[model samples]
Target chain A: MHPAPSVIVFTVLSGLGFGLLSFLGLGLPQVTGWEAFFYFALAFALAVGGLVASTFHLGNPQRALKAFTQWKTSWLSREAWLSSLALVAMGLYAFAAVFLDISAGLLGWLGAALSVATVVATSMIYAQLMTVPRWNHWLTPLHLLTLSLAGGAILAQQSAVALALLVVAGIVQILHWVLGDRRFEERGHTIESATGLGDIGAARLFEPPHTGTNYLLKEMVHVVGRKHAQKLRVIAFVFMIVLPIAVLILLPQGIVSAALAILCYLIGTFASRWLFFAEAEHVVGLYYGARSAQAVAG
Target chain B: MTQLPETSEKKLGLVIDLDTCVGCHACVTACKGWNTENYGAPLSDMDAYGSNPSGTFLNRVHSYEVEPRAGGCSQTVHFPKSCLHCDDAPCVTVCPTGASYKRQEDGIVLVEEDACIGCGLCAWACPYGARELDLAAGVMKKCTLCVDRIYNENLPEEDRIPACVRTCPAGARHFGDLGDPSSEVSMLVAERGGFDLMPEQGTQPTNKYLPPRPKDQLPDMDVLSPALEPVAGEPKGFLKWLDKALEAI
Candidate 1:
């Protein structure tokens, strides 16, 4: 699920790229009509750069176009299609903004709509896996919103409207943590249900299937994951949520401090997203000689 | 180019009784012996006579302490899980190549070693963790239900079963045509109320397990070793002392 190093870099980099694009799209209409044109063009460039950067992550890059064919079922296909469409819409918005000097109406709304679609599609990639109960939570949608909003706020630090949105984004981040913590907390409970056991849970493996580590154990079982999860939760709660908001509240001056706040929030969100994927345990983990939650206490 | 005629309504499976299974690992050894020779490639054992040596074994006995749900007794059931020969297999459907296919005649999920590109998608899709890629063979390997022996005309009628079943010391494994309702396998399952492994997975596994009976009525482990009489035994040798020291460790 972590994929490869290339995949991790690709996903994280693309997340920042598209997230900033969505924010820029939303922020453009709020600022001066002339400024919207300039930002839209710049954002279009960023979107393409991000898109190309992500292609290096694919195992078979040539077969990637066929991924869109599975859109009727697979969220991955949907993400690919939506990402492409969103790119096209953003590009068209850029063309209209730069060429026709169009600052408002369908062009503006199209960019915003496409941005929203891309965010939803991106989150759906992990959220759609029925086997992975942790990713299938409501926190998925919130993370998507926070991702773009946090990045958009940074790009919008020159103005007060983006600054205000950034604060709202902080509140959203805090809310996500408050609600999202329960998902990780209640993972054991879900596994018990999935394993078809009653209240008599906390099943510890007396012994593993084999003495040495296999693919499942190496791939699925996170030996240091619980600690990583705990550390990341603290990071997300304090660095991502609390500290940024506190900085924004204490510093009343303007966008300079807002930039720092946005930066902290972005760093926090990235860690949060990484943990979100890493912490997600698939049901297949059970058969792979993965000991239940009691293995953690040991 | 295809000439194999498919027969409908055939249910083939390996019936294993938990009551008789001694967990002696005879079937495990037999499976390794047969598959390594007859299958696509030999199951290799690396680092022999060294720190670590490991090889593939299709049949593995999983001994678990299960408390009887209906009855009051609790005993250990040595569960041997392999390819279930499911009616609707998730592993088969998920395979991009037509390599992993269910035989319409017997409903046994078999890997076509020739067609198998070793993509490893089937292994990931299986909930039971049945399919394993034979790295040495450069293909997938699994329990074939003694495909070569079952249909072979040269083998004796009684010995037409899988080598694992034939070599089981405790007579734990049973092989037969499950299509016939009145077959010994079906009758035994009906009488004992045999259960499927991980029915929640919805593989609809053909294989069934006979639940473990009460442990209390069985002879206690404590009664096995009788108290040694205070006999003036012969002088203990160096070998005896070494054996005692090894046992203590």
Candidate 2:
């Protein structure tokens, strides 16, 4: 809910970085020379920077070490574990490709698989939250994966592949938006269910727990105006998908055009991520008498 | 460590009566007063005595108006909400560090403050809004069910209950082991047809709420129809002559 800036940056940047690493791992079109070094540097910067940025959101960042110990049950721990593996493997693969001037096939494959797993683990962190019905669906992980692939393709300068994946990502984005809006109501929880008053009568919130905002209202029950959400969705779609596609199709394959597309895609993805958090309606909101599920939808 | 025990020896939880709660908020204040100092960290207030005064509270009472569909009179219900300490608690399982856990002995869910990294995931996992993040202490806090007092050997036996339960003016709150079939709370639940909150969420909450009993039926309007028969003769009384005398004057 709060859509903290650090988390947004972490998700988007890490997705792009891992996506790029996934492409390089496959050795698609035989990357070599200074190009390989450039790709490796960009991937490291995005992935490590994003991971480090995530720590800023923690209340006690120093105690985060214990987070790795609970991998048996916590997806957050799993993400940390997988990201470590991915980064370590990717580092070795980069050392071989850039310094030794040799293609490490096994290391590349391991790096690629772990990179993808890391993103999946990241998605699972949110997707596993049954309290937030919007993020509880399989569509959440699907959306995250598609975005990673699309962003990765763009960064890797794979025009044909990028265009194809971008279209797919765009379609998933629209579908997720359409579906996520109706998710809360589909769960069939009402004030009656929330308070266990279904057997007695129609229950409605007469008085809130407090006169002022509490942590639940501030964190879990964030309200975004419908009109503002719609406007943002359109802007997100235009910049994230439509403009990137337009730039790729209209301009020649070069550094300038690629950078432009990447910039627009990042901006668009950020807006879309913001909506992902903003539009999400936690089931706890039923106690607060939030408007109908359809109204909360983007 | 987050994995719940197969069976806890005791399921200590609160059973609140919807029929008797008066919405006085005594339990809320009582909880705040006791817990602010009992737990390791104080439940800090950000703007106390200021324009926007607010503080972290483990228990909060929410009042609702229930309009009966069967033409019964609308009733005001005061619902006090806190941690359910479910058999399968999502909050405990979602903790990245083994900080949030349910005790095996008493089934009381608690956060190990020393180990808690304060990621706030447990707060998100709770659908009941029972968990509150203490911004000042940089850790999550919640209803400990007066863990400090309930098992404190120093306290008087009668005063060992949770502060909320002890302070309830209407005696609407009951604290006992719901796991024991012979317990007073379990018998009360069986007799009153008590129900769990958000059963659909499948938390298997230890907390139970006894619904209000049906109201008594009122007399039909037709039963009083004969009383409205014309008081044909307001005559004969001394007051009748008084009206005529006033008119003549």
| C-alpha TM-scores of all predictions | 0.65, 0.94
Per residue, candidate 2 scores C-alpha lDDT tens digits across A147-265 of 99888888888889999999999998998999888887898777899998878778888888899988888788888554588889999999999999999999998888889999999
Clashing pairs in 1: none
DockQ of 2: 0.75
Residue lDDT tens for model 1, B31-103: 8898888856676665545676455556666555445454545454456767878775766654434556778
Interface RMSD in angstroms for candidate 1? 6.9
lDDT of 1 by residue, A62-102 (tens): 54565555454445556677778878777776666666765
Winner by TM-score: 2
**The best candidate in terms of lDDT:** 2
Off by more than 4 A, model 2: A292-298, B222-249
Measured by C-alpha RMSD in angstroms, how accurate is candidate 2? Answer: 2.8
